[model samples]
Target: MSSVSGLVKTEQLYRSQSGWLQRAFAWCGWENGQVMANIRAGRMLTDYGRYHLSRKQFIFAAIAAALVFYMAAYLFYHSALVSIAAAGFGIIAPRFRRRSLLQQRKERLKLQFKEALFSLTSSLAAGRSLENAFLATLDDLKLLYPDPRTELLLEFQIIRFRLENAEPLEYALRNFADRAGIDEITQFTDALAACKRSGGDLLEVMKRTSAIIGEKLEIEQEIAVMIAQKRFEGRIMMAVPFVFLAFLSLAAPDYMAPLYGGIGYLLLTAALLLLLLCFWAMAKMMRIQM
Candidate 1:
């Protein structure tokens, strides 16, 4: 009877301890179940413009940023408190990095789409059916991309599969555009759908659309080249303040000694904030939306 009572008490104690641990983790934002759910959702939600970072990449980025910020903080303030505070920014750095990567990937995908349209136009003009034209475009893309898994190629494969399964070409194109989430792609898909429904000359329509998209992409490239110098200047300007401060600290430590503590720290903080705001404003100004 005593053994049975002891066993029951032990089991109850274990359950209580486990429950307490779960609550503690939840309070600390470390709920295992929730974290797993978020990771899974992030993986599953990845689409054209949404990229997922692997666990290795995320950990590497965080550690790299933490170390860089820690060094920068120590260099600027020579204070452990400021270094720790700056290290905290590393937690969010990976998110910004991932967003930048996604944007670049989208831009590359858009350019690839423009190239695919040229092949598609040629195939259609050469008397291939729309479905065959996509297949021909895929082949051409394979030659240009040298990758069997490029985004445009994958999209074309999906559309080809849908067409083979008896789905309407218009439906497939619409779905592709929706997934792509690019204004240019959406416009092309709309035009294609309208042309198909009205039984218009698809070859001419595709040729015209391809020409327009190609011209626009060329113009955008030219604009990027024209503004490249301005972008470089903006970036240099953003770095000038930090570089100057670092120089002052190294070249004349006594000169910057007064900015080390007390009200000096507050002033330094305000100055850093102002510099960040200026950098952000300059970056926004340099970003030309095409």
Candidate 2:
């Protein structure tokens, strides 16, 4: 019986060692198949303590806080109101910061995408395959953009890992689209999958797509220039009043004090808010869908 127990222990140790070896190889790019499987299942690296949180986690956190507040209110009635409010605020603070960070990351990603696409197109035109184009684009992005470039590179690494795991090219491409949330990428992935399955002409498709993308980018640049001009004009117009008022107040404080303190403040605040709303609306309207 003791001998059998010892043999079982040895087998378990061997299995543990094998698992460790598999994981190490996976991290080193040897296990692309498993990496692909993980990506298709939406299990990527995440920092719950910092930027991103799942919707389910957010809901659960809110529910937990609500339950805690309900219990506190029930037990102490009015005495624990302050504590309950404080606890609720604490619970919501993390959610707010998480959302803010996600938005910031998203904006940075959007800002970098035009250059990324141009780089990819240039690489494709130079006779590089799609995967190599993306890899090259990642390097170009790292040099041109900021932190979001690093995020995009990490995504490319994840996709490469997935490919190593024996995941199909289509599966890996689909995973890339889902992770990036980019419609252009999703369309490109779908098109590539179709071409692969049917043995179609990928080079032609890429060339045509690249030309169209360049034209659209040109139009977008024109729109951005117009918007910037409008924004600049608005700023100058808004500043003119303040500048005139400063001169007036400094030149004749007794005469202009009431006007500057009352009507000027209210109008300035209203104008600023209106300008911000307009800017936000214009940005949303100008967002190109893919």
Candidate 3:
């Protein structure tokens, strides 16, 4: 109880120290209304596993999408109107980008969570109680991820705050698992909660749990390494058709001109549709959902 109270006081002091700096930034207009809104959204970002793309991220993605689609369409149909119309596909770019960001965030969380489990398990083996082990894990986490804003570190802050407020470790761990949306973390939490309820040996259960989850993550890392080259090759292959068309148009404009109208236009449309379908299929196939 004394240690927990001390932690709460320390947290309060740290936040109070940072508050004036934040207020100064706000007053100076360095963090204006729009920046403040995004900062609020970013804080809310911790509440869920899904990512919300900010205006800037979405706008940049949309512009890149529009440019790529326009270039491909112009290469296939030499018509300005058709190229501009195709660029409207930019509307869907943010959705795909958000999914990609969410996946990346979750993967990073998975790796960090694995390290956290190791630290927690070590603390338990060293004779700390479960709650103490959690607090001790924070020290290890700080060393492992120097960034103050790293997602797992923020999560530990939340968990520690809950602990300071006298919440049970089980409930805090459950909330973390839910927010994290990671299978390994969820399983570890479940196992932990069950062990606590059943008065099972904490050190033994944690050791086994950590070993199993670490092995799985290591396997995933190996698979990712194996598929990395293939994914790169896939991206290069997708760009080949557009590059070839641009080359032909530059080197032999007359040869490519015949394909810019009438039956050639229809053929190009079919080719573009085929290209899109193939691109979609390749993306779906390459995404390993494990």
Q: Local distance difference test, per candidate?
A: 0.80, 0.61, 0.85
Clashing pairs in 2: 32-164, 32-165, 33-164, 33-165, 33-166, 34-165, 36-162
lDDT tens digits, residue span 152-225, model 2 = 66666666677667677678768766766755556667777888789878777766666665566567557767
Model 2: residue 267 alpha-carbon error in angstroms: 9.4
Per-prediction TM-score to the true structure, in the order listed: 0.80, 0.49, 0.84
**Model 1 spans with C-alpha error above 4 angstroms:** 1-46, 226-229
Clashing pairs in 1: none
User: RMSD in angstroms, all models?
Assistant: 5.7, 15.9, 14.0
Please list the residue runs of candidate 2 whose C-alpha ends up more than 4 Å from where it truly belongs after superposition: 1-133, 136-149, 257-290
Q: Which stretches of candidate 3 lie over 4 Å from their true place?
A: 1-45
Candidate with the greatest lDDT versus the true structure: 3
Which ten-residue region of model 3 has the weakest summed lDDT? Answer: 24-33
| Cα distance off (Å), candidate 1, residue 243 | 2.3
